[model samples]
Target: MSFKTKEKEAVGVPISESWEIDFQDDFDTFNTENWQDQRIWVNNETHCYVPDNKYGTREVSDGTLKLKVINTGAQKPCDNFDKNGVQHPDTQYVAGRITTKNKHEFIKGKWTARLRLSSNGEPSMFPAWWLLGAENNESPVQEANENVCWPLTGSGEIDIFEHHGDHQKNHYTTGAIKSLGECDKGDWWSLRKGFDVSLNEYHEYSVEWENSDLVYRVDAKEVYRNVGQGDQYPEKMFAILNFAKITDAPMKGEWVMEVAWVKHEFRK
Candidate 1:
């Protein structure tokens, strides 16, 4: 359980290239300069994404951001809509989802997030720290440039860490989403792979562009590699952290994913 600690402005030691920190947010009171609450629907998820700590979903306390999925015991109106332009119906469950979209975006470099789950894997919980193409034509489209659909036309995907609570307790999936060269199509399982880690303790999950490869890491160890898949994700991408209720399985209590920090760097 190696914690990244409070080195919020840390410029990590690099080998071949001198990496320079370009964007960072330590959750020191939820920096609006680096993030925004993103509400959108996809993946046929069960819960609705909410903003501003509603239902105690996105709380920043003690220098960490807690993304929680709370069962409200009643359905409520939701604003999240899908690509087909269908608004999410009233959902009894709600959770937090935030992104660096429209604020911080970068092309090929490195992305890192220090985080940990509050409990071991449980059915229906889906929490992820990942990157999305800036051109993704989802909800909250802030610009006309965001007209491209996901995993297509350089609107690619990269999962730094994604935990499916239905699986093994200390395991998570990571890697790229291979595009099918078509609209709204991406291969979710081909390039992705799962690995085990200390689920309830802080760890730095990261990815980097190493020439023609996309390297995935747990803390500092290379656990998986998407060989030569770097060419699929040349466009700028934004960071996202969210906790989702994916099924109708009864939630025991509070489900949380605590994030310490998120940052990006480029070779200098």
Candidate 2:
């Protein structure tokens, strides 16, 4: 296994004033006009994605959005299903996943979210801040144009922040996922980089196009760059926030990822 990461540090990116905010949500409340709960299984992720804050899996308070993974301690019936219409098994874990799929999809802009975990990373916790192509053909396919499958023309993905708690605390990986020209065929580690950061505190995670290249940042500071890979994701995309339980290991209490805000910016 080869490594595709950089040492965490600020490399400096010139602040551009020519950009203006295009969309924003400060999480004054869980506004259905801008987002919707997404309950589909794809990653083999262990927890069931639930809606309506069932078991306190999602909450908005103090002007922030909290996506949580709650341990119910016993199996509960789940309504989440896969793309093939197979229902998820009754689960001991329930979590929240939200997306802007049909609400705020846009192309060629800066995406940013200020968020943090409630505690140090622990086993099985998988929290993410990312974007998926609007035309993705997963469950809840809402339109005729939304038929593109994964890693294809309109289904490419970009992860701005992902923490694999099974690895280490205070760390995350961010970058564009390279498409391999077929459904579900994508290179996840090629253009991505894992970085050390304080997970228990808020930091702005972001990805923006620097011409044809892609720039990844933490708190408005550049940390990594994937040269000329931005061309693969030209389709409109939308944001997502979710806390997943990815392993069978039992954990105490619950895990939380808090978001202060999410926004997009475009050239003026």
Candidate 3:
């Protein structure tokens, strides 16, 4: 794996600049080394592993991470597996979702990931690039179960991106901040007209944050922005790349999420 950093100034915004982290895993060098480092704590404690149900397994082949939602009957364990081998049936088919806990945490910065989303005759496939918090208090079970302690009303969550296959050409991304015993929120956007169904090409989705502001983008174009919105924004949060299933959808199906890389950079 090779790491390349590039800095460029935005064409129209004179003071605005951007930096990119390029990881060309042409030889799968980073698969075992850096990939493990990027796994987030939230996913780890939640038993989110590869090749599960909605989430699956991702293999490093041909210089890219091929995320497949497969149904092999092997009982995959959560990040914290016990010796009893007691399987969490609720977490079956949970695969291919990675977070940034038990490793590094970012306070405020820009995060972007490149991916190719696909559907496999499965109707409820949801491929998303979003952000969620790491429940870092009390027992792992209590932390994951917001209703048991924090309650859903006060639990903080910031979903930067979410798109479903059923909503062809109409996807929305959300952001939420919990404070004052309440959760403040922002409106969603309707940006989904330029997607190609071939599912073989790459697309970049990014979220930029600074202080109490945030901007979400697709294919490098700004889609949603919140200024003075959602409880001063998320100071420290982790991003997620997942292809999930819509349990309530009329038709049920499966999907795969393939990714090139996820990059993060700060403005100076």
Reference-based TM-score of each model: 0.93, 0.93, 0.62
Model 2 alpha-carbon drift over 4 Å, by segment = 1-17
Candidate 2: tens digits of C-alpha lDDT, residues 1-268: 1121121123332234256788999999999999999999867778888888657888999999999998888988888888778888888899999999999999978999999999757888889999999899997788899999887979889999999988998889998888888888999998988999989988999999888888998998999998988887899999999998888988888889999999999975
What is the per-residue lDDT of model 1 for residues 100-180, given as tens digits with 9 covering 90 to 100? Answer: 999999998999999999996899989999998999888778998998887795478899999998988989999898989
- Residue 137, candidate 1: Cα error in Å is 0.7
Order the candidates by lDDT, highest first.
Answer: 1, 2, 3
- In the predicted model 1, the residue pairs found to clash are none
Candidate 1 residue spans exceeding 4 A from truth: 1-16
Alpha-carbon RMSD to native, per candidate: 4.8, 7.3, 7.4
Model 3 CA deviation exceeding 4 Å by range: 1-56, 73-87, 90-94, 120-122, 134-155, 169-200, 248-254
Better of 1 and 2 by lDDT: 1
Model 2 per-residue lDDT at 240: 90
Highest lDDT against the true fold, candidate:
1
lDDT of 1 at 31: 85
